[model samples]
Target: MIYNKRLILAHFWLAFALFGVAILLGEWQMFIRSPLHGWLRNADLYYRSVTAHGTVMGYVFPTLVAMGFGYFISEAALGQPLVGRRWAWAGYYMIIVGSVAAVVPVAMGLDSVLYTFYPPMIGNAFYYIGVVLVVVGSWVWVALMGINLYVWKRAHPGAPVPLAMFANVAGAYLWGWTAVGAALELLFQILPVALGFATTINAGLSRVLFSWTLHAIVYFWLMPAYIAFYTIVPRAIGGRLYSDSMARISFALFLVFAMPIGIHHLFADPEVGAGFKVVHSIFTAMVAVPTLLTVFTICASVEIAARLRGGKGLFGWVKALPWANPQMLALALSFVMLGFGGAGGLINMSYQLDSTIHNTQWVTGHFHLIFGGAIVIMYFALAYDLWPHLTGRALLNLRLVHWQLWLWFIGMIVLTFPWHYAGLLGMPRRMAFYDYTAPGMFAEGVSVVMSTIGGAMLVVSAALFLTVLIRNHSAARVDPEPFTFSRAVHEPVSLPWALNGLGLWLGLMIALTITNYGYPIVQLIMTPEGRVPPVFVGGKP
Candidate 1:
């Protein structure tokens, strides 16, 4: 099926362009905080850069990439032109304009609330509005995905939806519902206070609402990578998916389990009781099951491919596998990093262990590894794999792609490992300066130096990534095979509605969310005295 290549390329290029900018901002942030760069210390500038870096990387880049990738998969994997191309373009522009609107305030030092925008620390009203617009734009995508799937189902009757498109739409559905928490918080709580219509804002309540979106949003960013693992990587490596049913079950589990777990992030906060925290922590552990399933499934698929290539013993298949293939290498490295990240997450989810590292650099390292390291390496692989197909031009250099992936892997390890160590050694997060000259600060200085070096390596890797894309775009056109997804080992002839449909999962998510968050939120709403007046950073208000 022919896709609108221009549309796909436009979204992808914009996403990566922002990623390149965020990479530089991230390095600058680490540099200014280090002891050696004390002369460059400016708290205002550092926080602003941190806000912009986190916003771009956490919200803008991944969402755009997922949306763009979804559109491509809708057409390529499902063999149909997108049902709402005009709407998709509108969404693209909305995201671009919204990102600009949000970013301008941060750049001007008017809004440095950071990506989470925890209130009663408020920013300019436009920042909140800008974020709402981005979510609104994504909602457009969510609607379009549903429409396309509905239309496809009606057209093809009982035929099973393509697994890639099915999973993509499931992610869209999940985001549609999950984003409502943050959206409502902005509309009801943050916006009114930011605009000065309300003097007092409920900080605890805002945190609760944002938490609804926060943890689940990671799954939103992660789904595309998971989509690639189940649908694209297997085929790329000459293997079939181990189980279509397992893939469906994992995605379903994510939709149901990923949302209610956000309260685990609030274990340190006083607004919520221990009961709610324990409930959320248990759900947080539940979320890990799907990830484990994915790891096992993907590994099994790779093993099948390796065995076909002639492997004798139990682990000989690992050696026989295609180590040089960029996608294969990325998958292996992503899994390794994910293991490290997951172990840290286990600590965070434990009520007892969380206090040890809460608000420390350990939390920062864990998320960066999972989101920036494990998830984004797959994004890099996707770009390399898809660019040629979308542009009808061969990649300028495969060697450059390989080098970029390895550098990214190495850089992330160097960057995050020290953070984990230093976090244990009592390094606080979100601080602009570390005071290395102070008593008992020598060990912290060593970690800071290590982080700065890693940050530099990451910037180098980012440059190489952009170079590969630019060179690929300018390369001579060449014919390549149509991009295809792998079939499951046991092809799904007919799926139960529970497995194939979204309604059952969506209802369960709503019920679970209400059961978990309803009481605490209602309690806060009833008590006006609990609300606190806004405090504007940088003396703006």
Candidate 2:
């Protein structure tokens, strides 16, 4: 039994560590602001901590969990062992090394740039090395994913791709393409300059290139969420996918539009041209089509399940649906949270509207709601659902799990909703301390009091979550096998050959990119002599 146990335990441990660090950082940044208030805050330390948090949560946990899921899917769908077990282990160690190396400098207060360390401002050289280690480690996973996809396609020939493998491959390809921009910035621009191999680097160019990666990374982070939406949510609701082909089409759409729209991040940056920003802004809005499709499809699948189970009326199905079920609850809340957050995103992506809200706490409010509130809630739900079975034990406390989710959702609303108001009222993000000493200068007292209250709520909610996780680990009479879930209905899907293909989607991505960015990017690289140097605007002006 021990020999055959999945590596899910290891994945849980890593996710817990990373999540713990993130919550603690949230606490520190929210409550104790002075440590970072001064400009003298160590760059090396700041960068290290930021990198550690980002890599562990953003890179490590997701990759490990995806690998765990991949292992299961590969066995079930393909009926074989992973092609290279040793390489997988090596990749794991590489991730560990990278995570450790990356965080040490930050905790020590030696690295201080935020997670995205653009050129000219350098962190400890070790920080760059650590990031590279992580990138390379994940690259191996991509290679493995590619090989797996290749083998499956070769074996099956014209047979339809399994929904599970197809989803995974879509994410894998999206990741590969997204990483290209960040990797180039890291390897060719940031690292060389940081290491002193180059005397000067174009900060504008660095940001422009990094812009190519920034937003798509969110998709990488959300892939696991999407995977669960497709693979687990339907089954939990006693239904199969609404349409297998639609799922593929949504993923294909995500891959096609996700990377190119990163320039929406540069909408306010001066270096990137307005035309490019406008083009990306359009794509940014367009990308929502695929996300909305997923939402509609998943919701319809749940509705079908409820109807089949004797639910009645358009809304009666909601009552029949298992709101107490973890995955259902997670998906439900995720849908609600995305609506609020997506509205905020729409404002940010607006070419003209962004100028009014740029760099304000509204941006923070939006991301925290989406990433921290929505995505993290789902992670907890998924882990809770998987851990007990993986550990061969009854859940330590199901009640606590439900309670924690409720508190987290409540806490997130209490914490972030006000930030939206404060941002519209002109609150800034990343400020270590507020300069609200003068009465009537701002809603100084009210804002601070409300934020503090929000902070406390968040802390309490996080404490509940930690308790739930710990209880699961220490539960008595742990079951050795998970409660297996099965779909109530299965649907067969076949697509027209065009819909079955990825070639069309790939072409769309290329065509859109060339039409939108061709001139700006080309001029940036080739006509450097004609360009005026960017003005530095941040001093005592």
Candidate 3:
């Protein structure tokens, strides 16, 4: 247990380092397009940094955190020791290797194809290998979750899966299915071709396969955050989950629908037919139903807690809610951020609006809202909650932790909102330096200024977070016992086997994917070897 906690903390430190690198790259990318280029004019450096930033933030750091959190939850949930501690350590080592391997190539200026790694835009062989390692490492995490679930079900035959374990296991199941597509691409296309095993790879097939992994990966990123919401939020807010069954329903729906919804990403692509895109787009909307339920249920739980605390009225609950409590503050901010971001997502998924905002700064803005605002805020809350427990000492300064959350929330909105407008104005994305050097660049000067100001604020927010984390580490000398979570609500003695079993959700996911993607993929397989790839240029940015 001691070793695992240390291992988890080590990953947290790596995550912090990766966060710094990711944000620094983001700042530099902004500089690349800045009126004052500020040493960011090198296009290759810009691309490499952007790729590293995206991969590190999107995959590396988040996976580490998720794996660490999963390790802790598995023991708690199953009430059994990890089946093989050696296996867990092996997974950890593989992750470390994968993270370093991926970063080294980017740092050395070898490949900067960005996270998607679409063929024809290929990078150095090591880059692909690095990515494969990361994916493989995550597979280990998934495998562990599977084993945990299997063992729990066998040992406690009639018992419902613990809420925390159920959510994590659902996430694992979804990831396992969705990742297969990307895994196929990496193995057959990117890795082989990058290593000189193939002369030319099918970019279309690669992308089509990658599209399978795209949107579903967001849910994978979000599952742990959701787990925290269902398990931690109620306790922190002095309430109970309104419905464990509702959470089960939500996870089941996400597993079934989220995996196959990636086609919406290809809405503008040509190789994939419009019919498939529509199906996926409709699937996209279906996802909103579960999310809406979650939003309402979570808020309702908070309200109930607030009312019990002597608050009055619909609006009064807001004030009664502990705004200073890091968990409560993060959850509130996450909701607001999701509202704005989720609306942008709906716009993107809309066939009409997608035409206008496709590949624009609006797309970037939307993801930042969802990924950074919603997911990252929960990370902050989790870190804050876990820091004292992990360190066996009280947080160095709870007020600073609260302040950091607010700063991060404010900074994110300020940073992303203007990007949305910029997208609408047809400002391109992923470029190093816009013709900002050209004469009359002053036309969009106001937007640029606002964006730069927002970027600066984000930098400040990042600094504040690091400060709090560092302070907590320094205060770890108190040597208090590791704190454990107690149940926040009474759980029923039994759950329906449908809620307990993996088979039903897995079957539903397969059905949805076939309904949505079977024809598209089959058509591609039958098409001639040489066709103008499925790529589409939807406007410059």
Candidate 4:
């Protein structure tokens, strides 16, 4: 832990810094589009900010945090120093360099294609190259995670790997495979057009390849948060994890179900057939099983903690749990938001229901509720828990931390509820401005007003969160003990190969991905008519 302290700190700080900038960009973008702020509107600038904000928030922040958190887990859970400390640093450099390269073009308005990089709306080649570099850097971390675990297992035979390390490695393995989709899209399709090597691109093929990475990447973002739920939160709240076996099963299920379900994202696209979409949709629903398992497992774990504290009655267990503890509060709130978000997800996953909300403001709202609300709240909890340990200083103010979490929760509800309503009212997403005077816009206009209010609250919440972290980082030392993780109710004595190892699961993920995506990708490549000439609109700055 001591050996890799600087490495972990560097990655985390970079992630939050990007997060801060992105939040401000988000608020600004929303404000400019609102009726209250017409003077701020600039189509070019708005899209540029959108591109930067999405890329930083979606790609940069999550990837860095996951990598840093994985490194810390490897050392702490495995009880060993990181094996490839130097290679880890090299990976960090690649990410840093890649981020700058990518952001430069976006900042200059040369790559306002948004994070999706949907073609034939090609951005500069530098943008694609920069993104590729970031992926390559993460792959290095993935390799390190695999090597570290293999070495540890060889050293200690017939022992169940520490649960936290086991989950972390699972996330790494998931990302390594998941990223191939977009990486291929960039290398073969987008880059060629951006570089003038090709006159046309198969837009359908590009979308298909991206669909490969689109949804699974959410799981990659989510794994660390789930790790916190299973390992950190229970212990922080004074309870043991409900079942070790259930946790392992959840991770395994996520690996198997999450990879092949990306085709669900393409239900609106014509190139993919109905049979494939239905198959993908089934797998998409299957992905929810792990989440359900986690919800049940974590709640049971929390109840145990509450009962341990002498709470009585059916729901009194919830009240008996610690509310003041930021980590505990974060867990409760995250689950609540996840419930709402997950329900929305079920609506989107359904073929018939999705047509109602597809490409509307509701889709954006659903995502924010899940990613920003459910997932990011846990990230805050993680930071709060880790800050003291990493800095060797107690947090400067606990009250501020508590307030920040509540504000984030409240703000998210306010922001997303209106978004969902407006989406249902037939408001389109990604629009720079809406004509409030247009026919049938009364409902949309009202929802926009509500959304603006919520956006304002979120901006305030983001400011408070950053302030707390900055103040806490500079505080004087108080605690001397290192941070600890939760233990399981029944710790494993021995585990099966499937739960304890990756060999079997990784193979399954590959076969499933091929079965799901191989034919569509091949057909796109082989058929000349599927290709369309690339049209580059956002020119180099």
lDDT (Cα, tens digit) per residue for candidate 3, span 1-541:
3335776677677777788768877876775677655545467878888889899888888887787788777775666776656777787788779888888877777776788886666677777788888888878888988897888788888887887888888888787788888888899777765666666667777778898888898988888788888788877877777777888899889999897778788878878877778878888988887788889778877877788788897596678877777888899889899999989999988877788988888898889879888998898788777776667666777777777788888878877888888788787778776665556456454566566667677777778887887887767566655334324345667888888877798899988887777777777767757333222111111
Per-prediction TM-score, please?
0.98, 0.88, 0.93, 0.98
Candidate 1 regions off by >4 Å?
39-41
Q: Report the Cα lDDT for residue 151, model 3.
A: 81
- TM-score of model number 4: 0.98
lDDT of 2 at 134: 75
444-478 per-residue lDDT for model 1 (tens digits): 88987898898888899889999999988789999
Candidate 4 stretches with Cα past 4 Å from truth are: 39-41
lDDT per residue, candidate 4, 140-252, as tens digits?
99999999999999999999999999999999999999999999999999998899888899999999999999999999999999999999999998999999999998998
Which residue pairs collide, candidate 3? 359-541
Model 1 score (lDDT): 0.89
| Candidate 3 global CA lDDT score | 0.78
Q: What is each predicted model's overall lDDT from 0 to 1?
A: 0.89, 0.69, 0.78, 0.89
How far is 204's C-alpha from truth in model 4 (Å)? 0.3
Per-prediction CA RMSD (Å): 1.1, 4.1, 3.6, 1.2
Model 1 residue 305 CA deviation in Å: 0.6
Model 2 scores a TM of 0.88
Q: Candidate 2 — which residues are off by over 4 angstroms?
A: 1-6, 34-56, 61-63, 438-441, 473-490, 493-518, 527-541
